[model samples]
Target: MKDFPAQYDLQDEDVLYFPHIPKTAGMTFRTILEDQFHNDDVCPATLNAQLKDYSQADYEKYRLFRGHINYVDIPQILSHKHLLLVTVLREPVARVISHYEYIRRMPGDPHYDMVKDMTLEEFAQGMPVGRLGKNVQTYYIAKLAQFDLNHLSPDEVFDLAKKQLDRLAFVGILERFQDSLFLLSYIFGWKPIINTRRENAAKDKKSKEEIPPSTIELIKQNSLLDIDLYQYAKELFETRFAEMQRDLLTKYGAFTHPQTVKEPMSSQVTQELLERHAEQRFLNLNPDISNSLSYDFVEPLRGTGWHRRESLNDRSGYRWIGPETSATLDFPVASDEDVIIEIKTICNYATTPDVAASLTLDVNGHPVQLEILYSDRGSSVRWFRAIVPKVALDNGRVFSRLTFRVNRVVSFTEVNPLNPDPRVVGIAVNSLKIFPVHAAKTESAALSVFELKSWRDVATFLEKHLGPGDKIAAPLVFQLKLPNEVLDYQTAFLSKVDFQWLILYKGTIENLNPILFNLLIHRFSPVFADGNFVVFTRQKQLPKLSFLALHVRALYEDRIKVPIKLYIIRQLKQIKSLFVRRSKQAETD
Candidate 1:
């Protein structure tokens, strides 16, 4: 169960499969694999000769099989060989553009010659345009599900591709190169190096403005399927990466590294390479400036020890307590710290004070001071806040259980003569918030997502305040809620912010991805987790961004806010489609 040999640990005889979808940073991943598995062992796999065609001994000898082949061409020996499936995905528009630019430079191919002198607009408007970058990524993955492209509708093919992606052991995002590398290393226990040097990246790439609007519109129009698939891939990438990070915490413990590692200067090999690379990637990503969100945003469903007693069967109905009915709540403390325990509850008693009952609240078996609730307030629901000293907590180890004993229930009918039944009901507990006393300050600064600029603003802030070696608290508490009110500060993962920012700001790849990786390590890690920030964004405005909004981040919207993430992704796709549709309509006119 140790984190080193992950739950998906590779066997000695395991076979790693890489469906090298073109322009997905596959060459970079392939290079990393070759270094780890020995160049001789990492063999090129092709459609002409699959694993089934190779002898058993040959298959056993080659640990890593990768090449640009049809997706469905996996060797039939998959059932017998332990297969570790992995791939990378890019933004559809960017990938398509990159593909065109790459092929546009080639002199040998007839297709390349056709587009060599012609502009992007000419290529788009040309007859038989389907041969170019239309749904190339989708076609690659869809082929895995149905060998014949005609077998399924485009939507059906995309759904199958996504369904199959969920089963993949790892799917890294090309836009999120460094973070993805860290995750792949963590997942497969490989020594991953940051290789920003892309293969087939044309020296003379066309600027976004240089490409005609008609061509750009056509690219979007033709690649809607790829756009959807890319989003799904992004979601999957972040999901598995979270699992890998959890494994790191389980095996390596928190904050084993507590400093911003500078990128290595012309170094040939690793360790420092990883540290520097990671540090550089995280450079611009500081969450503090984006908002005053604290660490409380994380909700630890497990290990933190907050639980509702299943034995009492309180889940099915309200925690109804008669005159003597008692209820207990338990919360775990990861580290001994002064915390204000907040409880939100709704009493069955409406506006009537017929329930003349006060429940005693005890923490760690001892009664604590809490404000008395009066039904006379006219509000049926109220929040009770109690400050508890750190020493008073039961925390003595990694996590100590803090028990809450509630009893002394008083019923309403006792005081109201007109009350029907005399039975008393205390409260139906709605939610609980156990946070450090100092976190009270972050509550007042619950800024809307609209108030914040780019995610870089948040990263820049976290880098200074919560950055590495700063002993504030492990996993700080923050209050981050999305405008949609679905993904609270806790459940949503935040690391993708750094990745998104990396893609947003362009320069030498050296400064962007590496420094963001640094931010991830120094500021974001010891594993920065929890629902700590709330993003208040309108559901209707999800797709549209300000002139300054990052289109790349918009493509992979999961890192922003949950609940409305789908809304944003859909909105972007819709807007793109509409823009294209209108442009075509104009051209026809």
Candidate 2:
């Protein structure tokens, strides 16, 4: 099977419908859903209340439907098309205990106070009278056959739940989660989801052994229907899993699990190459950690503006903010202080002379007064500076959003009749930096800056700056022109050195290819600890490091620096000499 772009667009054109029952490892499964489908195609109805306003057209538009929804509760529009129903089931008694813990821990839940004072047994016994009791899984699944849960008998509900399991495209057992993930991947033609972190699990939750036996018995008694349903689901999962394993062997000629499939060596080399390129281009840009937090227009942490990355040349790129746009940058602050925000903007679309664009700046929802730092009409570049008061930043957040509202916007078509570009553009931002007013003054004294223009310059810079224990943590928040050859050589040189590398790239880490990046990270595991190299991204799946050293010889190729190549050769010769000595000693013995 090959990777299907979207499951909805498959030959059968089936919708991937997941009726998520709470506390059944569905949150972890959601990571896969998000990765597999586009955000616009996934339904936002997590609860039934969210689904109340959705019309048939709304229901039909989404390719994937998930969240805390019951199958029967889904709109009738879904019934007209081919549907691939899937769900995960946890062990009944365990599920009940987990749900009870979840409710007690989460103050946001409406039932939080209701079960706060009750003992585990009391909670189970008392709650069993309603729809969301010990048998909630059965309650959700049985409703598929008969929507009216009040009328269905316990036996009838259990039987219907089993029938629903028989009809499901796949049934996942939460205990065998990894196996379930692999099975689903093979079945659905998805890239294998590896190292998914569990989400939404209750804090300080107890194991089955921690609970009193009486409480366990009480939960078991209440969850009789769910226990039976879970057993059936487990059986179904096992049969399907075995069949899938056989199919995988028959198709691919081996047991193809995510753990078994190795990531390519080229991917690792490529990641190092890209990260190095970012580092060399922006090294020594940040004067100090406390000075400023910069948000490049190409990659703001969070914002409202969206179009596409615009590049004037290979050396520089920026994004156009429409009428209004906001860029958020986060930095640590120990005390309250006023900060200066610098915006480098260009208004080439300005129709009026002397007035390129009128921008109103706001910091953390508070209006700020802007001062014209400098304006150059010849280059269409304007530098606007503003001071955000300490009161505005005292909102108990480490980060502040700087919003820009422009008075005028002109499309390319509006600017020129022959121009086919229809993009509505306001002022284009090259850099957005926020720093404490005091730190801005002290930036010149913080660190020695360098402008390494070539491979020799980079080598000299590294030799001068990097010591035995020196940590080269380059925060790429500003733009600097550096040659492409130096970027590659700098990366290769750093790989040969005895220094800590904490290179940070502020842009979208999601834009980088995952397989390559993960492989690169795994390569660093030998020199550093588990978390030494960290790049903040929007994904929750942690990269699993492999122990494979198959790429050692690959690193000895032409890409490596000359000195490093010589060092490797010398090390290899020493290893050979040691072996020869050992052989001679054995002969003497």
User: lDDT tens digits, residues 70-188, model 1?
Assistant: 64445454557766677788887777777666666677644676777766555544524224666777767666555566757778878877776766667778887877766666555
* Model 1, runs deviating above 4 Å: 1-7, 45-61, 77-79, 113-131, 246-589
Worst 10 residues of 1 by lDDT: 303-312
lDDT scores for all predictions? 0.49, 0.56
* CA error at residue 174 for candidate 1, angstroms: 1.1
Minimal lDDT window, size 10, model 2: 477-486
- Which segments of model 2 are wrong by more than 4 Å? 1-9, 254-589
Q: What tens digits encode model 2's per-residue C-alpha lDDT throughout 1-589?
A: 1112212223346678787887888876764564455455667687777888888888877777888767436635577877767788999888878877888787898788888787788878787543455688987876665667677677877887778778777778999887776666555554344422445655477898998898898888888888888888887777666665544444443322434433221222322222222222222343333535665544322334433444454334455655333332234333357777777776454433322456678777899987544344455655667778888777544345566766666666666778876556666766666777776544421112233133234334335434454434232221121211122213333465332433322121111233234335544432211211222212223342233433322222322356556779999999999999999999999
- Model 2: residue 211 alpha-carbon error in angstroms: 1.3
